[model samples]
Structure formats: C-alpha cells, structure tokens
Target: MANQEPRVLIAYGSKYGSTKEIAVHIGEVLNKAGCATTVCPAGEAATDLSAYDAAVLGGGLYAGRWHRDAVRLAHRARRSLRKRPVWLFSSGPLDPSASEREIPPVRGVRRIADRLDAEGHITFGGRLDESARGRIARMIVKSGKGGDFRDFGQITGWAQTIARDVAARTGASRGT
Candidate 1:
C-alpha cells in the first residue's frame, strides 16, 4: 500500500445548517492534522464505505430524534464501520438554566454509538432564534422552550481532540 495518510470523511445532517458548520470545522481540523478530509451532507454522499479509513457523523436533533439521513447512513454502514473507527455527534439541547450542569444525554446518539461501536459520541448545545424559526419552531420558542445556546468553544475543543485522535491513528497505521 502507498504511504498516504488515511482519508477522513465528515458526514453530517443539518436542519437549519448548524450541524453542517460543525462538520466543516471538524474537516478543517483534520486537514490541518494532515489527513485528506471531505465534509458533505450525509444524504448526498455516495454510500460506498471502502474509500474512507475514518468517519465522523454529525446531525441535528429535532424532538429527540436525529436527522433521518444520519440514522440511515449509520445503519447502512454498520457492518463495514464495525471494522474501522467511527465517531458520532449531534447538535441539540439548548438549556438556558443558570446551572452549568451538562446537557442531558441524547438516547438516539447513544443507541447509534452502541450499534456502531463508535469511538465517541457528543451532543452540543443548539441555537434557537425566534426571528429565524419557522411556524412550529417559532411556536416552540414562544412556548418558552428555546434559546441561543451554542458554545463554539466547546465545539472547537471537541474537534481538536478528534483531530489528534485521527492523526495518531494515521501515524500508527503508517508506522511513522
């Protein structure tokens, strides 16, 4: 085999596009770490898994469920992914309470992680802007269940960690 760095795919499903940005950030981090990376919508990507050595899947959570495409991709690639490294993430949970307690665990990502033997799973705070929300989303915001709660720092930190892990894996595999 050629001594090329492993390829990393950051596939994401975004409703209002926040998750897409997060995936882009991850791709940037991986690229800086010397891996060939691609960031794309999960539904739009080719389903063949043989080309990637590592994968990161991200999505938006709506009413306790991940975007459909994310779920479908994970399910479709489950068998093949079991023999490789995979990471899962969701962008959701905007709690405005003053307490600094961690956001409650999302059952969907956990279930997917268990099924795929994912290296790690994460849930980040989501955003809610009444002006940008749709009818139902606006109603939910008006109902007192929404706020802008995204933490860019935490998201970037997580991406950094993932970069390091991917770099380490590629280095080890290449005996560098």
Candidate 2:
C-alpha cells in the first residue's frame, strides 16, 4: 500500500450543487497530495469499496437529517467502508457557524459515522441562492436568509489533513 498512490473515493449528495463543488475541491487537494481520487455523487458511486483505499463521504443537511442518497450509500457500503479509512462531512449551515467552530453531526449522520467507524467528520457552512429550488428554499432566499457561506480555505485545510492521514496509513506519499 505504501508503494503506490492511495486510491480515494469522494462521494457526495447535494441539492443545489454547493456540496458537489466542495467534494470536487477535496478531490483536487487529495490528488495534489499524491493520491488518486474519484469524486462522484453518492447515488452514482459504486457500492463496493474494494477498489479504493479510503473514502470521504459528504452530504447536504436537510431538516436536521443527511441527504437521503448519502445515507443510503453508507448503508449499502458499510461493510466495505469499514475495511478502509472513512471520513464524513456535512454541509448545511447557512451561517458562519461551521467555519467558526466544530459542528457535531446531526443524529442521523452521527449514526452513519459511528457505523462506518469514520476517521473524522466535519460540518461546513452551506449556500442558498435565488436559484435554489423548492418553495421552502425560495422562501428562505426571498426572506434574505440565504447566501454562500462555505469557507474554501477551511475546506482545503480539512482535505489536506485527510490526505496526510491517508498517506500515513497507506505508507505512501505521492508528491513527497
């Protein structure tokens, strides 16, 4: 495992694309850090984790729960994910809270993290714009409560941490 680049899967579920962008950013960081990374939506990711050495899964939070697709993927890939290093993340807070301090996973997400024995978890601020779908989403935006709050620097930092952990665990460092 130390001789070759670690293959990492980054799976995410997003409602309005912000979370997808976050996942992509993470993949880029991991790739630059010497890991082979695949970033895909949770629903599209393969259920088998046999091909990857580690995984980072994230989802958009909704009504205090994780995205359905992400939750389902975790259930389907639990056994395989358990055999590898797994990290989880949530993006849903529409304020600066996520960047200011640690946000514990909601009940459902916490359960998924526990089941997968995740190496770590994070909560990133979310984004809501006028283009958001659904009545409630539009209402929130119309009420002037929605805006992009994701912190890319914080996100990049977290991804770098995961890359280091992966390299340390796999005994391989691609770039250095």
What is the C-alpha local distance difference test score of candidate 1? 0.78
TM-score of each model, in listed order = 0.84, 0.97
What 10-residue stretch in candidate 2 is worst by lDDT? 167-176
Tens digits of per-residue lDDT for model 2 on 1-47? 66899999999999999999999999999999999999999999988
- Screening candidate 2 with a backbone cut-off below 3 angstroms (N, C-alpha, C), the clashing residue pairs are none
Backbone clash count for every predicted candidate, in the order shown: 0, 0
Which structure among the candidates has the greatest TM-score? 2
